[model samples]
Target chain A: MTNFPDIASIRKDFPILNEVIGGKQLVYFDNAATTQKPRIVLDALSGYYEHYNANIHRGIHHLAEKATGAFEDTRRRMQKFINAPLSEEVIFTYGTTDSINLVAQSYGRKFLKEGDEIIISTMEHHSNIVPWQMLCEEKGCVLRVIPINDEGELLMDEYEKMLSGKTKIVSVVHASNALGTINPVSDIIKKAHKVGAKVLLDGAQASSHLFLDVQALDVDFYALSLHKIYGPTGMGILYGKKELLDAMPPYRGGGEMIKEVTFEKTTYNELPYKFEAGTPNIADVVAAKYALDYVDTLGKDNIAKYESELLKYATDAVREIPGLKIIGQAKDKVSVLSFVIEGMHHQDIAVILDNQGIAVRTGHHCTQPLMSRLGILGTTRASFAVYNTIEEIDSLIKGLHKAKKMLG
Target chain B: MTIKEAQDELIEDFELFDDWESKYEYIIDLGKQFPPLEEQFKTEENIIKGCQSRVWLNAYMDGELLKFEADSDAIIVRGLVSMLVKVLSGHTPEEIASADLYFMERIGLHQHLAQTRSNGLASMLKQMRTYGIAYQAAE
Candidate 1:
């Protein structure tokens, strides 16, 4: 038996894991949707709202000073977490969707012209797709999609072929949320750069599983949510090359984002504040730094190594269950297992699993087009995080077996 | 009307009707009770965009309350619209704005709805509320 991290010790950090659901300990398999935060991260939230609840960067009061320092500390922490070239490169938004929308509106609207092609893969989330579609509608640009094969891997040759002189941008996911395919983003960036196109990565699913160095990849823009990585909701990071960020237009018109404002004219603020317009989610942003700290303590490599083993174990075990078909069986994958039973509806399976205190995400997963591409209505997706254990995977398999017998 | 009368009216109209099939029949039946909206009102402006079923919502004010008549092509979605109309229509603009819609839980309507279906309903309500807001502002 391989030596694994102590499941009991790890489970202790999350209070909700101890609660009985339907008279059983909760087996949380819905990490991709959102993660259960550690006590430290949770405490950081209450600590912020309770102790230093004030608007950041504006007031000269003591609470405001404290709030400003802690809020900026998160930006610095994110800069280090992603190995971003500078702290100014990090901009905060509501979440991944909001971050992507900022890029689409600011960069895509400004740079893209009529007949310019914006290329994206078929595996992108609706967050990545809809924003660009909105831009294309506004700017009269054509949206080009790179097709995926049966295994859910991007056809790299097809991707390269799709790029041309007219290709203005290439935006793709760093890791597919549904398929768990860890895309070769570096290669994609290099290929796009050769064609004089900027590349943006939807890093929502990759931030926890992979170590991101925005400078190394030379990725033009990267967007991800902190909630999906064990932080609070309503906080996300958008990292851009400083020059690119400096050149882009402001996303929203609000209080914090202006240098000087009058009825006659308005001058926009600097790189990050230009993008972050409103009074930001200060409490959540402060808590988000602790999420990065938690990941840092684990070491990304160790987390990936353990998760890869868990994935293999899950795949092998699930393959044995009769009439169960795992969706998206790519060789390179994160710890996501999407599957469908021969006769059972994904929703029915989810309800049955819930009865057994196993939580999993069911339905189109906000990737309705991908579901259409796969010829399935939806899937039951079980995604793993660093805190998830093989024991949890065992519980999931057993629950499925019981659910099949009961619902089948 | 008393809260109980309103609650009973909603329950009788929505829940006892059962499946979206029966519920939609009730909605189409409700459309018969309201005065006719002009054929010209069927323009794209009155259309609710994200609905899987084609829906047309038209409204007018009667004294202090706003009254609406909505129609849809699909059965279940039509029934959903009927349920919304029952709770939302014939209420003051402020009342419509302030309604918590905890009624969805009572009807067990949203519990059975898919995410898309839920979102569509929410979107339709948002549109209706926006109209109410505009009407109130104009007043």
Candidate 2:
């Protein structure tokens, strides 16, 4: 009945929203970790398995052709979704962690050398941080960190000062998972490129909430986890500039990654296949297209607009609660409200919320370094998506009030 | 009580709550039963390696019984640790080493434990059991 993208109908599409826990309807606020897959994306997964399940890109069979077509269809879809320069630039991997590891192992190992410096930020997930650290350790490179201010925004002036000839690569998260800070990756990319460093933006958090355009961002590399974007788990994409991907060596050397194999020398497959070794996640890849379509159908602009409202509402509501403090108040952010109660532990708050069937993520959220940087162990995180309604936010507020009475 | 008896007692305790809300609240309440781990026991060796929060567990043998003192930065995990200590401690080394945690699944608490946290929990139990086995062998 009401306009503003018909949130109720959209909520119904997510079947898990109907889950009754503790005699209450499920209120999912953990979108930053992973999103609930819609029925359409689910159907595509089963339909692929039901009709045409086969190893992609080799067989002359009909099912193979259909599957190969559908699987490749997702690559093109992702290319369009992010407005990449070429479909060949889209390389499928396990998830963001795999994608980051690919860049670190293949490109980083090949190019980076002793005394070289790589710049990362305090807010990166461990997946992003560890791979680079491993690469740095092997290559004898120095890892430089971009410091953040009290508000969780990156210190741009400090980042600018750090840019020099020794800086070989600058990798950072586009949006912080813990803080919800929308980083100025465009500026970071530009400055790093000026210093001759190839920039890799960890787009795992941003891809779900913000409009992504690799071409527009002109990033050397960008990693996305499809599960964070409402697609199935175990599937994601690594979007690299065509030239960089071509220049980088194969990540994993196995089947479907080589053209000719012999005892003497082997020729690697071109573009994406070089990185995506072995049999790819064919079923999940095919369904990922429908996930993108669902996002496109709802419209990112619309989703952002709606989610922003929810964020604002929840922020206001939580402020009214006694002894609660919001964290990560960046000037630009995406719909995530991280907070801490004065005396209550994050897990206690999380458990109490779970009791009320209002699920919110608690603890470090895989960003322990960020938590340490902020001088706190962790915060109870409530993130909003397109399907979330104000009513749900009210329930969260009410639940927190009860938590205050019990735990405070 | 036997380890099995302790687990059965926990299952009965959880069975009193029909909904996950009350069950979780009761679990949180149980955290208070755990005496905080001694400052000396909070050293790096006793810390669990993976987490959204830090958990420290220390084990020692008194006669045949293995006593565990544990603490967590997160209260809910602290509650879980308290329950584990209740069920696993005060048992003979062989009994502690061989105890099967069937009550975890029976009480439906297994579903609430994340794969990572469960792995950490499993590791904590393993550390305790390994300690018991080592002490038993030493004796």
Candidate 3:
């Protein structure tokens, strides 16, 4: 038995947990969509706006320098968090979707050619799938998908066969938002390197639960959203190899991204600033460091251990419910428990659960192709975080029983 | 009954439930009791796509009265559609286009109308009104 963090105190860190909805205590089971921010993170956000509100990187005044220092400090923290070789490799963006779009437009469009194949998995969120599709449409590149088995595990052997000289890049989710399957991204990256293909891992879900070491994995690009990791919304990071980032064109032409802008000829900024276009989400980016620090203090391994136990407890209890089938039963998974009732619509279940103040995500989960692959419309996903407890899982189980009875 | 009268009746019916649980239970029962749209009417053209649930709505003018038949894969959505049909169906196109739908708010199900929920109820309301406007134009 692993020693878990004090969940009672951890839950206390997030004020939203105290909220009452529909006359019931809020039980948040939708961590996969976005985790609730800790007080430290929230305080950091308000602190930035109140204490040091200024446009970063350009102003010479005291407030500007302070804001710039804080914003850039986040980059350094994220670099350490992900074990990137250089802080300059961490480019801030809107979110995971924006990060992927940057690579698709700048790297894929610039390098990929006709007949060049881009490989992705069937279980990818729409963010991962759509950007590459958009790139392929423009560049005349072929898009290939690695199929999954009945249990939502990637067909690695099939993926191996799919890789070849034509494979330009392989993009896949490190941990699936819909399924919670912790993908074998290390093996994936190694195989892609063999075929001379770059690899980009969507770390939106994994950053919260898994230890991210980009240098060890030799991953070329890593993208994630801060909101999913207990940080503010509208903030994300795109960590690309310095060499590749240096070679790629700028994603957007704006003030920070440009070194010199004359109508005749324009020169771009160095490293991350080249990709970070305009004034970034400075306040959210500043607050993101506190979120990461919170995770660091609690320890990722501890969080993972506790969440896994939560997943096991939830899985065992949920299996007893009649007509309820769990989806994506991968041997290696995070704390996501996705299931579908035999005769009940997921939305109907969501509505019932909502009234009980149990927030679960019920839908295709932005992974339509994955749902189609499983031969199901959607699943009701109850994802756990470090702050979540077994009692909350019990609440979810009770809510589900209520849903089953009422719907049945 | 006029649209206003039908809405008042729905509000009155919902007022009987003391708690949200019973109110939702009533809505779920209404959903289950609500008839499914005929197979022919569940075509792609009739489908109103919501992010969470799929709704099929078929509207046509029955003489001078506008008639609407709808179904949703989600029971709660179907219940909402059932309410819409009960209140707006069999009314003149002009009447439906101008009808105020205050019962949802009064019944404490206004959260369903939120765009974030995207249960298709909001879109269904809009589509019904669009149909009403279209039929009225033809007249």
Number of the top DockQ candidate: 3
- lDDT of each residue in A1-408, candidate 2, tens digit only: 237679878988899889998688999999999999999999999999899999899999999999999999999999999999899999999999999999999999999999999999998999989999999999999999999998999999999999999999999999989989999999999999998999999999999889998888889999999999999999898999998888999968899899999999999989889887899999999999999999998888888888888999999999999888899999899989999999888877877788789999988888888988989988999998888989999999999998887665
Clashing pairs in 1: none
Candidate 2 lDDT for residue A56: 90
Q: What's the TM-score of each model vs. the native?
A: 0.77, 0.93, 0.98
Estimate how well candidate 1 is docked, as a DockQ score: 0.05
* Per-residue accuracy of model 3 over B61-118 as CA lDDT, tens digit each: 8889999999999998888889989999999999999998898888888888875446
Q: How would you encode candidate 3's per-residue C-alpha lDDT over A316-358 as one tens digit per residue?
A: 9999899999998999999999999999999999989998999
Scanning candidate 2 chain B in windows of ten residues, the lowest lDDT window is B111-120
Q: Write down the C-alpha DockQ for each prediction.
A: 0.05, 0.52, 0.88
Compute the lDDT for candidate 1.
0.82
| lDDT value for model 2 | 0.88
Best prediction by lDDT: 3
Q: Using alpha carbons, what is the TM-score of model 2?
A: 0.93
What local lDDT does model 1 show for residue A40? 93
- CA RMSD for every model? 8.2, 2.5, 1.3
Cα misplacement distance, residue A119 of candidate 2 (Å): 0.6
Runs of candidate 3 with Cα error greater than 4 angstroms are A1-3
lDDT (tens digit, per residue) of candidate 1 on B1-139 = 5334565677665768655434434544554454444677766878764413356788889998888877654334555676678768898887776666655556555543444552255667777788678778878
Task: Give me the displacement of residue B45 in model 2, in angstroms.
Answer: 2.2
User: lDDT of all predictions, in order shown?
Assistant: 0.82, 0.88, 0.93
